[model samples]
Target: MWRAEESKEAYEELKKKLMEGLRENEKIESILKALKLFNSRKDRIFKEVDDLEELREKIRRAKEEVIENLDEYIEKAVKKMEENLCKVYLAKDAEEARRIVRGIVGDAKLVVKSKSNACREIGIVDYLESQGIKVVETDLADRVVQLLGEEECHPVVPAIHISKEKWSEAFSKETGRDVPPDAQAITDASREGVRRAIMSAEVGITGANAIVAETGTIITVENEGNISLVSRVPPKHIVIAGINKIVPTLEDGLNIAEATTLFGTGQRFGAYVSFITGPSRTVDVGLETTIGLHGAQEVHVVLIDNGRRDAIRDGMKEMLYCLNCGSCLASCPIYMSIGEKYSCGYFGGIGLSFGAYIFGAQRAFVDGLGFCTDCGACSEKCPAKISSNDLVREIRRRAWERFGLLLPPHKKIRDAILETGNPFGEPPEKRGEWMKSN
Candidate 1:
């Protein structure tokens, strides 16, 4: 389990992990190699776009509009979904979300899930496990994390820090077989494990990549086909997503999904995109439509607020525009050094801002607010044009205001500039002395 960011113990542990992560040459080399591969695919995505900048601008404007009028859009989405014979619930926080989910799950013994960072954001996995529900993750990376009992290191690649040998060992233990230390072998084992879990599950829970307000459809994009099986095979389907994920129309939702796929994994499109509009229905038996004819009988959507509305009120509204594409994580130098151990909640640069607002400013500070370099790489790669560097700087200023925490070096430099009018602590006349000789 990941430690709480606000605690002193967690702060100390984060420092230790950061040091260890930086010095591990093998891990560093693996991550750098992954980065190279990602950038190569990312370049190809840009090459295929006719007007990437125009599309980005359009998405930015759309996101801003949606966030600005979030309440109205949510209301519209709920109404439309209910009209499609789907149940909808609004949760103000994590606790409320978990409670509503439990009610929907009722007497379910086994639950299957797809890849969903939003579920992590609400602590749903832990909550369900505590309630005695056997929850299984179907995503390959998520499955690895589950078996290892480790926190998700990256949003897209949850077990990116784990090597192939480690994964092979985990799979061998899970299946009670001598598994080869090969990528395909490990994946095949995971597929078998997840398929069994899905077949036994009574309830299926997932997070939506995008929610269409006009049609009340939930859209999910994935490379693995697990999401498809989990949503279809079960008798009950539940979608838990943030209120900010709602878009005005299906077209707008697809646009956002396309950008997210391109920026997240550097793909032209996801391998599988599922558009679900409610429970499964068939009219073959008679003239009337029959629910549960092939797929799920009931569909439930829970939209959680969890400090997001408060974030807007606090002037950190721009964060709501994030597509969770994870491009920012790949570009962050600090993230590359410390991995996800320094993460407050989400991954990489944007996590700093998310930590401040969602997890609290004090927690975020002790969690490593000063680590950011204020570089604009994250901003440049963001599909929605969010300036995460600026957000980090803003959070840094707030940290000082709230807790008076400042790096000793920065404090000394500021003091020197104030006292001697030079960062070198020299008189103004000597400021150019080095330039004269060198």
Candidate 2:
């Protein structure tokens, strides 16, 4: 949505941030540690799978089928969820999604939320705060970033930039106590406050890692216990997720979740894997089921289309296969250098593809597409086998076409392509000259 000048300025600012990150030893160390963990876990997964290639093929087929049948699956999901006592809303865009959530959360004073990238994309927290609602982030990493007023540098670990020493200081300031510079101490301090907030909050919100259409379930994968608390404690539970997250069946959703966890942080499985069908209910009384007996009395699932349907229609169908594992970010030299400080919406090479639609070409260009090396490292590590480097190059080509700002070398290449049907500048008649000479 940024103008040309604004986009250009954003690009320059991103370059500055990259340089700053390169100079920060602590940040570099953190990235290296994450990379190490990722590699080790990847090796384990490769060894654990009995048929690696078969699994990849199955997953690829499954994802393709789901995307192709997205509309049908969504309809089924809505019906099944409603039958389970969960209200469903289809949001056409970020603004509409936010408005729908606002209407559902009307007059609620306090809300607790888990780490959901969808929430960030829709700007829900800021909008809610503007309307005088208090929202607390339950994820420890999310809490750290929220307290410091910084964006998440990584999908799984929001506070990757914060060192233990600095994090302890922040926690101490937040808690008004001299918290020790230890991981446990900081976590304990945050947990104590968040626990109270969760219990007293009027509503809880989360993002779905995947949705099962047949079972009408929302699947969330997390390493922390925060999401469990966030989804259960409040009287109302809301899930906001992109339409692309829907799968045909619960098994398919689990497969995606497993791959996401393995690739996301090198974990064999997430510490917490939650599947919510609807409001918590019990069939203990005379074999008759009662809704909202223990957990949230009301459940709402807002499936957001936003720019995803447009993206699929506009020839970016493969981009929707993204699992949001953050593996591409870990593998991308550009992402590792600059972090996600400049990405308009999501982060990493896959983020560039989504950005082109969700944030516009100008913003996507400024986000990091111009600086990509096109080495295909990201695609190699991607769980879904998305060619992120190729996507970035295509976006760049589109940018060049629309903007009409060609460097001299690019102009020459364009001229050659137009003249010879290739960038080599060879005439059609001379196509076989090289073979003859050889």
Candidate 3:
């Protein structure tokens, strides 16, 4: 759908924009501040719960069990989904998924999409546009970035890297009308623009935070109401989600969703939580079954593998447990400093790992992984405790093995450290010479 070079360029531009948003001195401080807040909140939330550690262990086991028996679970999910009259498709890669969506949307001019990083990861917008479909992102944050024709810097807050003033200017240009540089004015303009897309969209696409295998339900959570509009207003709704997002039951899905919301955005619950089971159906008058009256008539769920199965087999399965809350991105020192360019896809710690495998290490390489300060802030704040820093190190090692590419400054510093104890390689006696003289 999209070339590797184009994706790399997009990532670099986003990184530049992110760095421009932060003050030189405030970057690390702000990252640490956010980390502290997140850590404190997590400690408080799980402090009194005596069984949290046990629950985490159980979840890990459950996830592992599912993965171990992945084929069976996938079959069960497909059977259950089909039984409910909803279409289910298994896409091995991005191309198949794109083809399925394009076929379903056949000649549709207007399509509205919810904020789905999965879709973004697969290059859905570029693919659809290639087929002459006009896809509009309905999420306010997504809409802002789409109008500006830029990649998202943050997963949760797509436009967080952009200031309100810039948004006001963008809105003024898009609407050809005067707009005040105020929060309300900017919000109103974005809302209006997204609303129009939602109301007129012939097809809608969204990403599921979790899919319940037991109940054949797709779970979506969002702070903005755009997800609701995306699912309800359009005549046809399609969900593109990673296969790892599946859970054994609705209760398990709810637990994962709740934990993601709490830790991801520091919220008790999202503003809109939509759980759609099959398409809208009613058997009211004279035992006649009706579909699509209240919401979308047809619902299609595409379980995408891409490289997730390989990742799971490679012992990087823990990454599949991500809820895409983007908590790590907010707290990552590297991400805060370099912004979105730190990685290729998704953003933040997980993105780095995914980028290495998906985009390849050479194309995704940035600053020899020196962008990361190894502060462990991202892992500390990650609800899943994903060990992002360790993953980055592994990625770097893999890069060297695969491409024989060494990270620039880090390679030099590492060699210096090996030759001598200090990175500067100054004589041991000179280490204290400056202190003694000054």
Output the number of the TM-score-best candidate.
Answer: 1
- Alpha-carbon RMSD to native, per candidate: 3.7, 4.7, 5.0
Which ranges of candidate 2 are over 4 A from the true structure?
A: 1-25, 286-288, 403-438
RMSD to the native, candidate 3? 5.0
Residue lDDT tens for model 1, 181-243: 899999998888889999889999999988998999999998888998889999999999999
Provide the global lDDT of candidate 3 against the true structure.
0.75
Best by lDDT: 1
Clashes per candidate (backbone, < 3 Å)? 0, 0, 1
- In angstroms, the error of model 3 at 399 is 2.6
**Given candidate 2, what's the lDDT at residue 224?**
85
Residues forming the 10-long window of minimal summed lDDT in candidate 2: 402-411
Q: Give the Å error, residue 70, model 2.
A: 1.9
Report the error of model 1 at residue 306, Å.
1.1
Order the candidates by TM-score, highest first — what do you get? 1, 2, 3
Q: What's the TM-score of each model vs. the native?
A: 0.91, 0.89, 0.83
Runs of candidate 3 exceeding 4 Å displacement: 1-62, 366-370, 408-438
Question: Looking at candidate 3, what is the lDDT of residue 377?
Answer: 78
- Give the alpha-carbon lDDT of every model: 0.84, 0.83, 0.75
C-alpha positional error of residue 75 in candidate 2 after TM-score superposition, expressed in Å = 0.9
